[model samples]
Target: MKDLLIKNGDLVFTGTDFRLVKGSEQLRQNVESILKTSEGEYVLDEDLGLNRENILGKGFDEELARTDIVEAIGQEQRIEEVSQIDFEKNGRELKINLKMIEMDEEELELEVDLDA
Candidate 1:
């Protein structure tokens, strides 16, 4: 899959031309987008993204959070399996570490932080 490259919430450009993201990089971007979005926020696909309202709170339940995050990440079609997932919470910030295998056996190690 190929998509317009985005960096820091903006499209990438070089020499007045936009760049494209493909393969693993594209998958990574998708996963990151999924993680950062709140459930029901995407107009076209309300099913996509994590349930931020439930996932973020003073009472942080690791198990439930893990399940929800895994479920959200699974929405990406390129992912074949989810491996290790670890979490660290600091005040209102959430840090997530994940390892997953893609459909073509490509591995992805990602770190996602949520400050919502």
Candidate 2:
């Protein structure tokens, strides 16, 4: 599958040409989407996002955040297993390290940041 490339939540293009994402790039895009979207944000796909209910309150729960990430990503059929997840919080910033195996048996590692 090919899609218009997106970076930092914006479309990426070169001059008059639009950049495209494919293969592993597409998988990375999918993973980003899964992490960035909050539950109930997409009207048609209500269950198609990460649940941030626990992270929204005053106190941050690392366990809840990890569980939410695992559960949300597990919903994607392309992801076979979430092997490892590490969370680090500093002030309002949250960093996540994720290791997973795709349905094709390919290993993937991703690091993401979120504002808490």
Q: Write the per-residue lDDT of candidate 1 for residues 8-106, one digit (tens) a residue.
A: 889999989999999888898899999999989999999999987656888788888888888998898779888988988888888999999999898
lDDT of 2: 0.84
Which pairs, if any, clash in model 2? none
Work out the TM-score per prediction: 0.92, 0.91
Local distance difference test values of all predictions, in order: 0.88, 0.84
Best by TM-score: 1
What TM-score should be assigned to candidate 1?
Answer: 0.92
lDDT of 1: 0.88
Estimate, for each residue in 8-96, the C-alpha lDDT of model 2 and write its tens digit. Answer: 89999999899999977787788878888898899999998889887665777878877899898976788899899887877778788
Taking every candidate in turn, the Cα RMSD to the unseen true structure, in Å, is 1.2, 1.3
